[model samples]
Target: MNKLTLFIIALLLSPVAVAATPIEQRMADYNPDGNLTFDAKRGEALWHQQRMVDGKQRDCNTCHGKDLTQAGKHVKTGKVIEPMAYSANKERFTKLKKVKKWFKRNCKWTYGRECTTQEKGDLLKYLSQY
Candidate 1:
């Protein structure tokens, strides 16, 4: 009816507004009280943070490597992992289920505990930078 209403309608139909990546959508959902600001640095730090488990230090990078753009190998299984960056790998973050599956498996293996929603959001933020 009004110019403001028309603008809102246009924005709502816009691709950028409608096409939120699965990861982006998840991070937004993870936000607590709309106050969460996903920090890439914090994510990166968690990526590299070492935790000694069973006399061995492990981190996200232990299997994923430091470069999200490069393929990494699983330390234990010797399976090759795909690049994690959305820019580098188009399939990445395309599906929320896969992301959740890995987060659950990896967090347990590396951190020995399930990651918190904040941690998951932070890690997504970090990977987004690549």
Candidate 2:
């Protein structure tokens, strides 16, 4: 094989060389303790689990909807939320800072506290599947 042909082959395989998604890379940053394990099933359960918010029961599904691929609306504000599934919305989990910002805001709003690292990892893992 000529040098140019080998370069083309390497370029074609470059995507495979890049293993982790941006979300996964962010998760790794959060897991400095090196013991965290993410579970999508747990994340799904968390997404559906309800808690009292301003005397009303709510969960992530209240705003994100049961279908991650479909758009959802805020129960009170009525603001449209883009689809949560990465497949449906390519921008869903692309940025580390934005992901953390939403997690901080949403977890407090939905569960009355920030999510633990495991929870965040699991949620990202679950959403990335779609």
What range of 10 consecutive residues in model 2 has the weakest lDDT sum? 21-30
Candidate 1 RMSD to the real structure: 3.0
| Model 2: per-residue Cα lDDT over 8-87, one tens digit each | 99999998887777766777777878798888898888888899856888999899887889999988899999999877
lDDT of 2 at 108: 95
Question: What's the TM-score of each model vs. the native?
Answer: 0.81, 0.82
Candidate No. with top lDDT: 2
**Measured by C-alpha RMSD in angstroms, how accurate is candidate 2?**
2.9
> Which regions of candidate 2 fall more than 4 Å away from where they truly are?
1-14, 32-34
Q: Each model's C-alpha lDDT? A: 0.84, 0.85
Pairs that collide in candidate 1 are none
Local error of candidate 1 at residue 23 (angstroms):
2.7
